[model samples]
Target: MSSAIAQLLDGKALSQRIQTHLIQQIQQLEPQKGRPPGLAVLMVGDNPASAAYVRNKERACTNVGIASFGKHFPTKTTQAELEQTIQALNEDDRVDGILVQLPLPPHLDAVALLNQIHPDKDADGLHPVNMGRLLRGEPGLRSCTPAGVMWMLQEYGINPKGKHAVVVGRSILVGKPQSLMLLEANATVTIAHSQTADLAAITRTADILIPAVGRPGLITADMVKPGAAVIDVGMNRVTEPDGKSRLVGDVDYDSVQAIAGYLTPVPGGVGPMTVAMLLKNTIESYERRI
Candidate 1:
């Protein structure tokens, strides 16, 4: 392992800067726009982690001068009822963005509900229209998590152009979008998943190794290329020896930090940037709507 410790990518600080900029922008425009930009986040179940994430998003919205119209429902909320609620929010003139919290109850038709959201108001950028826009390299709302990852990279001058980037995970939310974004930045990207043979071999070749597999400590020092930028997008709740839980990312920070040239930590890294991007998408949508 290299003795040089990786340069920390302070996502919390970058997110705070974005929040400050958004606050100024909103303050300057809200008066002529007749109201602040509004975002409505719809939550379906009582999943503790999901609840905490929603609360964080809502609080970020408030900090940036955006209005929040969030609602929580029991796990038993019906699909039709949720669809109706989305339709109502879609037509609400005051609302510029709408996002449904993920991991909905098993019975709920998550995809259909996501499709029901109007493209312009799809805050999470999970709607088909936005995803299509992203795929086509057209301007539209971006998926928050992936966008956060990109923003953090650019902030630190880690250009993806002409680099070999390996993304471990295929989920539409992070890994796929992340690869596309990196490709858009002119990076040659490779995606590895559970079935990929010799995962470490592929990861070791990456100039930028991003692991969003949600498996704590999946990527260790040996898996990383020396001087590579390791962006850990994974969020897993792992229990310590004392039975206390903590958030961790896919890369083994203790080991990888000493090997990688650049690294983003678990709790304060991509997580804060995700919320910052959510607020940004809302503000952008509001601008277009007004």
Candidate 2:
């Protein structure tokens, strides 16, 4: 496989362009709404990773001219307390989007809290209402990461129609929604997971392969089809022999790059696109509220 056979999907560049367009849209819409679109990101615990993600989202909201109503809570915060906060934000006219950062403390019921967010303001698109809408192929806010993957595919002119798409994860956040999106685009979709038998066998059948399972390098070059479009949504942090940590995706990038026709790099890939879609969802909710 020659290097010329592969091309980077470049989600970071596309995400910046998305932010610019969002900024212009916000500026034009602010006068009529009397306020810029606002997004509330509720994060619990001192998990450094979740804190970093919240900060990135807030910064992106600021750059896109959207207001942030973010909140940070202690890991020991009660479920009822968090529920009350969500209810207040749901009714707050100033806020257009609401998101709960994932992997909440073990004591909390993440699904119950996510269910409480109003469907229209469900920015993360995990609420049962939003998920139902997605299942029905209705017009509603989409899951940020999966939506970003679809947006990237469109931007790169890689249509899923008539192609075979294998999504290797079953989480509501990325894999399930990702497979649904590909099906909506007329692709034949198959979903495999970490527990699936002969995972590599299914992977080789895909024209489009998206893996969101957290394990690093789960998708090796031998598992992929030549010229397949590989969009990696997994993010894992590992310590190197030098005692330094770095981020990596599910796909074995260095080897797979030589075979895939289109691929997204780990740090600059789906990560940035997820934040961009969060801003886009906020703006969409803002327009509908008016």
**Candidate 2 lDDT score at position 5:** 53
- What is the TM-score of candidate 1? 0.99
> lDDT tens digits, residues 1-290, model 2?
56665799998999999999999999899999998899999999999999999999998988888889999999999999999999999999999999999889999999999999999999998888888889999999999999999999999999999999999999989988888899999999999986799999999999999999999998999999999999999899999999999999999999999899999999999999999999999999999998
Each candidate structure's TM-score, on Cα atoms with residue i matched to residue i, is 0.99, 0.98
Model 1 stretches with alpha carbons more than 4 Å out: none
Local distance difference test, candidate 1: 0.93
Expressed as tens digits, the lDDT of each residue in 251-283 for candidate 1 is 899999888999999989999999999999999
Off by over 4 Å in 2: 3-5
Candidate 1 lDDT score at position 289: 80
Model 2 lowest lDDT segment of ten? 1-10
- The lDDT per prediction is 0.93, 0.93
